[model samples]
Target: MIHVAIIGQGLVALHFEVGLEKLKNNEIPDYGVPLRNWLPYKYDDIEIVASYDVDESKVGKTVYELAKRDYPGNHIPGSLKDIVVSRGIHLNSMKGLPFKARGREEDKGIEAAINELVDEWRSLNIDVLINIMTTEPVEPVGNAGEIERRALNGDLTASQTYAYAATLYSAKYRPVAFVNAIPSPIANDPGFIKLCSERRCVVFGDDGSTGATPFTADLLEHMYERNRKVIDIAQFNIGGNTDFLALNLPERNIMKKKTKSAIVEDILGYDAPNYIRPTGYLEPLGDKKFVAMIVEYYSFGEFKDEFYVVMRINDSPALAGLLVDLSRIGRIALDRQAYGSIYEVNAFYMKRPGPPGSKAVSKYHAFQGLLNWLGISDPRMQQARR
Candidate 1:
């Protein structure tokens, strides 16, 4: 009966609620109550409870109300009728680095927002703060001290400070895990990583949303296994959410581009000249993600072949399953006193996984390892191992 609190109430948060519901209903004999259910395992059990968001429309709304208004996808099956949405400290959080917003004013004071949000979180006794916001590149390690000073001095906004304070608080608070579902620098920062180690709190991620790229990696790997020469690979993605909107700025995407490029390059063991960044964002598509990739290869002597793959997926639901798994795993890690990176779980669950110099493992292998670690024995994971 681990009580969970979600920090963001966007599409990703909605997906997490869906995953929590599935876990709740996954009943097992003598397990007392299912750990994964959306509702608390019991009435007043307070398992998956409360959500916090800064959106004016979402604040003070019930989870059910917010779900109906913003995410009509119904990613989470049941109506979250009882779950209440509380006002989260805004901390003036921004989605991507070199933050760019189409309409919003930039003068929203950050220090006030963050202080208020932190106060709210502390008051709520939140055990877990899942950051499912968009990707943002953290400053290089050397610049962290100056950034920290700026955040503390009210010179930085809530969004910027979140990366630093969240790391500090996570390390200071035992039994509380900070899970980053986005490709933000908080999870990768050396200071934060060390703090997590000291506090024995779990810090997971860099990116593991293998929606299209990982699938591409798998396809390329299979081709390479047959001695196929991959001459070029190009991936183009378009979406209409904050994740897509964040990429419009190059600064936010520096690490993301590096990470995605490396994943493909490592899989093929060759440099791909055809890689492309996420191109444009179309608002009509909302949270749906469309990825089109073209792979060109020369097989046999003087024979040229090309393969194109198009993947369209509901980004929220696609990642929902993984987040649910990660949240539950975070709880388990806390229970077992797991500390630092939680490599076994992180590698299987995150995108740019492992410590520097550690061999990169496939998503399938990581998923299998997670299932095994959780004693889930899910057939999918077992099949993945095979």
Candidate 2:
């Protein structure tokens, strides 16, 4: 079995845990899972063995209990009860927001905190660690030595702490993969990449591409392929989730902007005047976020054309589906000992695919590349050819 550990027991984590169990039990169809049965590891082979969180309300609870609280009308899988939310290294990730939170680092110190978590992971035989944490502001530690130093000295953020511990776990026990589903720059940081490469582990991410960003990417691709001169682009997302609340802060908000805005230049081969990021948070809207984007581009003969898109995206569940694919892929990478970030894996799923200067292509191209990496052909194309 692919034993999985979640870094944050938030809505996305809850959704992933519950959804995976339901998929295993044949209670729910794998509608959102992108690769589905095509992967070498089946859905039932994945298990949620552990979860970590800093919130007082979540720490002592079972995944089942949290699921029931967060998803009132939905059916939560009983398998979730076996997994309890454990305290993690907080580093004030939820400090500005309203969650009474604390971390293991607070009680045991950073060294002990990291060692303890690695020891726990060793005990659990965790193969993959999925980080769906609150968006925290962090810059790339360009120097690999600095990453090691900060991790040892406790100058890192919460997500970085967890990532550092995962590296330690890999060094001591076995190979592991870390999927950073938030905008924490784990995959993008040159230092982290070098460390992971040396340590014999894999890390995928820098903010997942779930909503308007991917759509904008594909649209930008269309314009570029047709040789359309793009004038300007403006896209923004608003939601009621805790992530949105966290993004309301300028520091956290800029991280999302950096991840989202990179696509325009990467896809179009030039920078476009763009304002793309999470705009606001309304509690009543909950996980279903509103997205609005407008693109103005020049067609042939200098004809100006514009298009506007409005969507109500269920922010958490969309990302939750992505975690399913990431989990299995992480497990797959562990077998191959693919130390460091896989650009093909990250390009399709991550808003900012790592290794520093990697370009963000449209999901259409990324998907084809992803399938090539997986050594799987598109079945529909085969059928069409036949």
Best by lDDT: 2
What TM-score does candidate 1 get on C-alpha atoms? Answer: 0.77
- RMSD per model, one decimal: 5.6, 0.9
Clashes of each: 11, 0
**CA lDDT, every model vs. true structure:** 0.62, 0.90
In model 2, which regions exceed 4 Å deviation? none
Error (Å) of candidate 2 at residue 13 is 0.6
The residue-by-residue lDDT of candidate 2 on 1-386, one tens digit each, is 99999998898987888888888888889987889899989987888899999999999899889988986348787778899999988888897998899998888899988999999999999999999989998888787788778987999888987888888889889999999999999999888888888887899998889988888899999999999999998888889989999999999999999999999999999998989988898998999999988989999899999999999988888898999999999988888888899999999999999978999999999999999998999999899999
lDDT of 2 at 290: 93
lDDT of 1 by residue, 168-248 (tens): 555444356677666655555565566556666677766655577567656766776778888888888889887788777
Score every model by TM-score.
Answer: 0.77, 0.98
